[model samples]
Target: MVSKVKIKINDLYKIFGPKGESHVEKVKSGMGKPELLEKHSHVLGLQNINLDIIEGKIQVIMGLSGSGKSTLIRHINRLIEPTAGQIFIDDTDVLAMSDEELMNFRRFKASMVFQKFALLPHRTVLANTIYGLTMQGLEVKEAEERAAHWLKRVGLEGFEDRYPAQLSGGMQQRVGLARALATDADILLMDEAFSALDPLIRSDMQEILLELQEELHKTIVFITHDLDEALRIGDDIAILRDGRLVQQGSSQDIVLNPADDYVGDFIKDINRARVLTLGTLPLKKASTKGIALSNNTSLENAMKALVDAKKDSVIVVKGDKKLGSVSMHDIVHAATRSSETAGEAVTYR
Candidate 1:
């Protein structure tokens, strides 16, 4: 994890007020957000944000609206300068980079997908996708080849000649994705990229992103307000509240052990049976097994299989080898338990 870190943000802060800098010390001295705002008339957009974005993994920053999730992501590319902090990408000081250096970094090192599908309305899909490449002074022929390749990869093959208005909302977002991917940037900054799509379309886009990530391994920083979306797509999830990080860890860690009541309530409505996978369940020594199921199966599906087969327990297998066994009772109990509980374990084989 240490060696693979692609971006590190240290002691980041963003205060929105003319006198914001003066209030930094007050806020740091154990002042609550409400009190600070009331006394100083300043809004803290982010507070002491420290994060390690691992290479080739999705790091989701999620919270309700006004929680500073969006504010935190923009600091990566210096889209929104921080009041105080240091940002390092590949150990390069982003905050210290010159204008020309920042321009090159944005052109070649990072690409962004916005919630609004910020496509050029008049430009053809191919033209828009190739915009980044052309900015780098690549030849038109070479740029078109790369852009066309990514357009096809993102399922926009025949729509290359179509403008943004000619495409469906989902298709327009696909064009946006292709444009970002065409840049061949090491980091993908997706700010609620699929939130504007319909539910089914959003789900489809999520699957598409996951499929692409499996192959591309881009360092992704995804911003979302949806807990389900975060859990589904994020390899590491960071929860923010009132401009402060409440918790950060794997999805399983966050769900099984929420940092506080705020976080627990945030995930209270989540369907655990769907969110949890069999591999994350407690593993036990394989014993009397009625049916064998893959360790990667979802808890919901495993429960359904157990019910359909009239089995109390199922042996968990990875490949041909038995890994452990999990019982219907354990699954039910684990799924129903309050987030505050120290979750029960499934025995491992």
Candidate 2:
């Protein structure tokens, strides 16, 4: 079943300068970021970005510093207005909204989670969590109820009375997440929300986000520079380079078939066994006589299952229906194959 697109971005461009609009023609005429800046004194922030973010899916926009990843996400909420383009939420033109309408949209329709936690230093966790709700003129009792629910959901039930300064970085970030989720907004704009945490804490936060997503199914726009994080959390990923979108696809598409050497370099060192799933690999017809693995099982887990069961192959199933079978040889080949040699069809024997 095709998922509906919740947010649509078309021909998006952002150039920073007094005469940004005048230089749009030159930018469209094939001028690069550096050339535009060095020649015309305008900093190119985003170039002709087009994307359709599906509803109830995590859409990750990733790029290194100055790649315009942060810039792109800010555009979604109109925190930063575009030089030229259109942003549509549920087919409503965001740019066409009146100032009051835009204000209401930001207040009720979308919520942001910042990398720095963005919690009020003086306010208690409970108070910070209800900040947005209070701004919306929600009744104090009702806002507190909603805030408490989300704080508990984020595992911060007991810490609501604690100030942001009392909490650790991870805990503070959790408060940020709770605050965002408490609003019950449909769209979540997370701008490097976990980047500052230690590795283990970051992983924990990722698990929490995934768990919450399974239930809430919000249209989440997560911005990150880390490829591993992007692969782990994103349902769809868009990679940008020097203000231009370089590639956009699922983890399988990016890992198995990178758009270019730049993208291939980003994925070359990644653990393919952990990222690629059974459903992504080409399968062969075989008897469903041995152990069965789900279509979504990772290649690493599938390999372990085969080894533990002492089987050469396992039938891949989706629910009660058998899809196909995968062999140990196929798993190894798919995991180790480089993107340069990746297009050859898999033939399990």
User: Which lDDT tens digits does candidate 2 get at residues 117-147?
Assistant: 9889999999999998997889989999999
Single out the weakest 10-residue window by summed lDDT for candidate 2: 340-349
Off by over 4 Å in 2: 285-290, 318-323, 341-349
Instruction: Give candidates' CA RMSD values in order.
Output: 5.2, 4.7
Q: Relative to the true structure, how large is the alpha-carbon lDDT of every model?
A: 0.90, 0.91
Model 1 score (lDDT): 0.90
Instruction: Quote the positional error of residue 53 for candidate 1 in Å.
Output: 0.8
Q: State how far residue 302 of model 2 sits from its true place (Å).
A: 0.9
Per-model TM-score, in order, reads 0.91, 0.93
